[model samples]
Target: MFDSIQWLIGIIKSIRINDIIDILIVATIIYYLLKFIIGTRGWQILIGLFILLSIWLVAKILHLPTIEWIFDNLWSIGIFILIVVFQPEIRRGLAKLGERGLFRYSLISKKKAIDEIIRAATFLAERKIGALIVFERNIDLENYTEGCVKLNAEISLELLISIFIPQTPLHDGAVIIRDQEVVSARCFLPLTINPNIPKNIGTRHRAGIGISEETDAVALIVSEERGEISLAVDGKLFRDLDPLTLRKKLIEVLEIEKPDFIGKLKNKLFGKKKWKK
Candidate 1:
């Protein structure tokens, strides 16, 4: 017991600040990766992969030559296989990383953007015009904007409502907003493979949820069928939000103070708990 205690002390002493930081960074990455895959089909694939890796490890430890050879061959193609299998997740992670790290805007600008978005969504919802508007936060959405018509115009309630009007050329796809501007319209986003999404939800809703699932972007959907407004964030959908709640929620996301205040309180209470970005 004494020797074990000494060893523990030695191990604790050896852990430097840099080592702690390194461990924290790795832990954060793993945590986010798990969060990314959780509740999706990818989680099942991850479980299978983990089992295979464990079997390989056990076989190597037992000196099983045949099993070792098989696993070695499998590992040779593992990179390609993983890339193909996890393409969506990989794209999402990379998109998250490539964004300008600080997702901030002036208070006045943020309020204006939020008001414009609320106004547009209200207008679209009133007309029962299906609209999918993605508000890019920390995630740069340019990769998903390919083949979209580049507008790069200032946000306007008129333009937003007009874009989603039925029979319009750009009515089918999503509008991508970045830095308080509509950068593109008719942009295609990846469809989520999450099986839990309701079958009754149409492609527009799925795409909204999909883009939100894949990035830090906020997706606002105005359902043509129901004339209801919904918001998707981090793979979860909050359906049938009234204009007041929608405005408040958008402000909560765009404003730094509320998130920062909540984050600081969480850190003080829980210490390094996963705070929303």
Candidate 2:
């Protein structure tokens, strides 16, 4: 016990500031990794892998030759197997890691996605259809997809409009669009508990504002009572925007490739002056 205590003391003494930082970085990564993996499909896969790893360690300790030999052989291709099994998660993790810099581009046209959403919102607004569309931005909204219908379909005016047609199966909840794909529909977002929100805005708008508060995502809402388009971002809601204005707002927040000098000049010369407020 004295020897063990001395060894522990030595280890504690040997840990420098650099060591502490290194340990902190690793612990932060593991903490976030576990936080992200929990409640995801990959969580079960992780549990299975852990059980297999535990079995391998147990086999070695118990002198189980057959199991040990099998796992030893399997370990050779284990990395490749893992890559295949966790392909989606790995890709998302890498994309998320590099999203602020290198991997910022989406598979689909950002402008096109926004346009489709605008068209759908216009269609919904004209008929007094209430809608909530959340666009995933720098932050991942994967947690919202749970218990929701996973469409995984490309975003389109028809699809977005159909989902919110009154009395439709998915009409009750918000739609989450990530990149150019409508990741899920009928997603129940956390509602803001703040009483400061105007009484005129309903549950749909509240949900849109709620998600924006928690993430960097931008939300487009169609007010059924007023038949106006609104945007919510950073916990604040902007109400009563036209199509052109909404487009500008989405492009601005989403950080899409900004208009060049020529386009800006065109806007200045010919296009309707960008709307304010």
Score residue 13 of candidate 2 by CA lDDT. Answer: 97
Candidate 1 structure quality by residue, lDDT tens digits, 1-277 = 9999999999999999999999999998888777657755577789999999999999999999999999999999999999999888788667756653424443347677778889989988888889999998766576788899999788889999889888889888999987678889999889878999999989988998899888888899999999999988888888899998888777766553454788878868887532222
- Give the residue spans of candidate 1 off by over 4 A: 1-108, 256-263, 266-277
| Weakest ten-residue segment in model 1 by summed lDDT | 99-108
Pairs with steric clashes in candidate 2: none
Q: What is the lDDT of residue 32 in candidate 2?
A: 73
Question: What is the Cα-based TM-score of model 2?
Answer: 0.60
What's every prediction's RMSD, in angstroms?
7.9, 12.8
Q: What would the TM-scores of all predictions be? A: 0.58, 0.60
